[model samples]
Target chain A: MSGNSEMSPRRPRLAVWKLASCDGCQLTLLDCEDELLAVAGAVDIAYFREATSAAVDGPYDLSLVEGSITTAADARRIREVRAATTTLVTIGACATAGGVQALRNLGDIDDFKKAVYARPEFISTLATSTPIRDHVPVDFELRGCPISKRQLLETLSAFLARRTPNVPTESVCLECKRRGNVCVLVAHGTPCLGPVTQAGCGAICPAFHRGCYGCFGPQDTVNAPPLLTELQQLGLSPPQLERLLRTFNAEAPAFRAAAESLGAGGEK
Target chain B: MTERTIAVDYLARVEGEGALRARLDGDRVEEVELRIFEPPRFFEALLRGRSFEEAPDLTARICGICPVAYQMSASHAMESALGMHVTGTLRELRRLLYCGEWIESHSLHIYLLHAPDFLGFPDAVRMAKEFPEVVARGLSLKRAGNHLMEVLGGREIHPVNVRVGGFYRAPEREELEALRPELEKALGLAAETVRFASGLEFPDVEEDYEFVSLVHPDEYPMNEGLIRSSRGLEIPAARYEEEFEELQVPHSNALHSVRRGGGSYLVGPMARYALNRTRLLPKTRALANDVGLEPVVTNPARSIIVRSLEVHYACEEALRILSTYRRPEAAFVPPPATFEGGSGAAATEAPRGLLYHRYELSRERLIERARIVAPTSQNQKRIEDDLRHLLERQIRADDATLTDACERAIRHHDPCISCATHFLTLEVDRR
Candidate 1:
């Protein structure tokens, strides 16, 4: 963990950046109430607008980027962010995948603008919301609609120590089993994406007696086709199955293809 | 003639991406635009065709700070549309959940976001160096709220437990009972917060705000109420569109909301406190009176006191609900097996202010159309008005001091820019 200490006498500078997002992922850092001051002691919180008004100019030692790139300006701005950091970690579904806003990717952008705004011309937006990895090379991707607080701290700790983060890429079903939660899919015959979704959220939905809605996006090796077939048999129609796959991580390659196979992707 | 411009390219200490620009010509403030460049995510546009059941979770993505507000508004709107009224233990649980959000969101603003402006510090971290106990108290208070949310809603941000009719699962009696001790501590912390906020030196400034909020006859509004404004405008949520309109301005991604005939109005802590002062819990009301906070807080900078008082009420309210909570028989009230298309609208008091949601559902229960009027969006125009008025008074101050003051004034309302586009560079020009 002390691998990078010899390189600089000063504590590492950490910068938190936002693109197009709900600010939830960045908030995950603040949500670490107990660990926040300790983390601050370990590093200089040079730039984090949501928590502080302070900004220290880069080249920062580590940068945690939240949200997706949804505008041309953001696309350009993200490049600058990448250039300013030695290690760049994308946090949450928005930064790792395209988030819920990526729903625009499968619909008509013009129609979307018109639907939400009376004067569409006044809005400056890209047709699609794409993740940070699409725009810049990311050192790590922490996935969740709002990234898990535990994983966020671990990621920060790992980066400070100059080590690889220990985030697993396993499906949420594994977590559910470890949690001793009854399989909602098998027991209650409820449709769930746990079998195909990532594990970071601790299988919270299933534990809550609700079916997983795949807020964490896809797992490492998703066999979504079989899962979709099972869900369809469980009474989810083709469109329902498509809508299920096309949520927070709609633009993720695997989920996008799954939605498209169900005849639900591209401009609506 | 000398020309000067004050501009803040990227605003800090507020949620989301935003900037401020105010242009002043000589002694007169020419233009003050609360430019909400937080790229429009098209939440309303994207919601179309999704199942009505998905509204709460989906709309909760609008702002991370106040997801509960969105969830409550969306769920209530959907429940209204489906003709399903959730009452009894379920209703109490929802209110309890909202109290958690209020406590969490308010504590965040009071400590991390707004406190720095008053202390002349860049951030809370710096403030914590000198006043560790103050910062610790705030964090502890915030944790109590987040813990309460985790027990009920599953996680703090974008909780998985909320559904249309009610929660996905009802928390056990023991689960709720466990939160009481923490909440008991939080109540004292909240009172301390109110006192601390009241002690801050506020700029001697006031605005003639047309305060608006949800007003329940029996209690301080959080979930259900008729929409009432300080200017004698009272209407049900169904008539929201008839009275107010969201107009598209050339400079902003967020549409500015205004009363149909009137111009800008305020909705938030000040608004809620102004319209529902009598409805607050006795302790919270007493705390306000003890602090010498006026019944109607027109000074936006003094909103900290109002927000802190609400936090006190929320903690008390949570403890009250926890004491009386009985686990509902069912996790959620099931929607009808068959559906007939209908439209419904509802407004809920978010920690920020009143959040309004309207949805038109198709026969199949798919959301045909959706409209969301976030509190910040409703307050955007009024915020600009505040800035304009502020610039008029501080026009003689230098660009740097004036800009700093402008940013502080904006922070007073604690605008969630992320929710507003749904929502600051300050430029002062002297010629």
Candidate 2:
């Protein structure tokens, strides 16, 4: 068996999609100010409305989807996007863990809508904002409120090279230790999610003298119950701890379960 | 007589999801809708009960393109409620940080999003193939802004350093010094950008825009000022709800803002420039005049020029702030020891337009309510009005051309619907 010699290989076609998001994750790709032009050269960039007006019909090689699926149109659109892409990677907390907006998933969406909009009847939305994986199969998940640009570049590089992306799934505590920053939780009595929150944001909140609010979702081996207990001991009440865990990557399984276990319930 | 509808299901290039629909009934434009389909994030609702300290981080999530706007408005509002203001160096640093956003956001719009439309490319990558130097300059200018943010606020996209009173930490003078050369280069590039933007082919369209912006007595408005309009209306930020009201229209999730009983108004660079042109630094003012920009420009398409002028001003301002840099004794001012509560409102000039945040805090300093009015929401009605005007003027153009031209008109506003739908998407239907 041999590869076809007559046809030349083409750059991988990349499509960036947004559903319900802050546009930060995709902006991360553009925020690669040094590498943006080079990255553009390596990919076809078939469809990315936020960055370009040029759109190509897709059967894309790789699709980086941002935002959670929160509307009826988006639900159908994700299926269409999935059908049109060979490998679909969901980027950011919204796409992977339902984002900050996912707080509505636990509450009455109507009340949420009414609270935000004066005439809620005019608004169209799903009852809950859910992750991309909830609607369609995702090949990979890149976590962050706005994903780390380095990780994003790596993920894109992996797609271009047809290699497995090397993204760590360790807790933020490990990252904090690696950076040699003193533990805000252990040393300063600050209630932090570093114990269970996934690494990637470089322990940013902790480095800033604040507790990690878990923008990167949960680590692979998250036992958030223990972290919640620890937080309670550090002066965070059950309600405060629940609100803390339920931000950014709020609906992640480990964090959600922990919040529920603390009697915060599914309805925030 | 063709009675047809032209619909754009999703607007490209502009930030966030939104659609535009225009219906023509036998050459008469019957209906024009700037449909903002960006899914609602319910930020105003979710902010309730959160600590007032968290407002900056939370509201910053509204728009990746202009997080500083949200952060500034939030911090200012919270500061007002707490009965404190970041004084001297702290205030200057906040202004410096805003200049970074102005540079970044404006450059992104001018080079990547809006420029491509004028240059007849699908996006900047394609445009770069033709105008590499221009694109590179824009990116460099944008990076300078990002570098400033990184040094001051930690990161560019969603800066984590900002709090209610000030930043978590301030940049060292040496750290700021390192950014000077790059910003100097950006200053030159921004000047060239003004010349380039002024040279773009603009449609012969102008509107009697009721421009609104914050105007500080002594400086260009960014963080603090009374909300003033071209219509001679002046109000404190607290009176924002009274002067301007949001209409819950069926076509968009984001409410359409109007001047109480009046019509649409313009904001952002054009508004800021038109209303506060006298306050611009000499170099920035020279660049604007060199480009033949009038003190009060009404052509919507020429907003690109205004943004370029702003980029020039921002770079200069950033440099001035950096050169006079004295790190504050403390990174942030602590709130008052007393536990009394109050409500406060603030309007800041986001790169795109005005961003207003009104917060009602409890005695315990928890946010009882949050009312955020992003610029895009305020500009939505105006955008539709512009489209309607465009259709009336170019009613006879081919469908493709009309759609392309309409998209261009919307781009002039550089509408960050993401800011609004939370803010946008575009659809055009002609029947």
- Number of the top candidate by lDDT? 1
Badly placed stretches (over 4 Å) of model 2 are A1-7, A264-267, B423-431
Docking class of 2: medium
Best prediction by TM-score: 1
Looking at model 1, residue A16 earns an lDDT score of 95
Give the winner by DockQ.
Answer: 1
lDDT of 1 by residue, A19-123 (tens): 889988888888889998999999988898888877889988889999889999999999999999889999999998889999898788999999998889888
- lDDT tens string, model 1, B1-431? 65667788888888987778877778888778888889899999999999998899899999999999999999999988888999899999999999999999999999999998888789888999988998999999999999999989999999999999898889999999989889999999999999999999988897999999999988889999999988999999999999999999898888899999999999989999998899888888888889888989988889999899999999999988988988889988899888879999999999988899999999989988999999988998998898888888878888989889888888988899999876365556566
DockQ of each: 0.82, 0.73
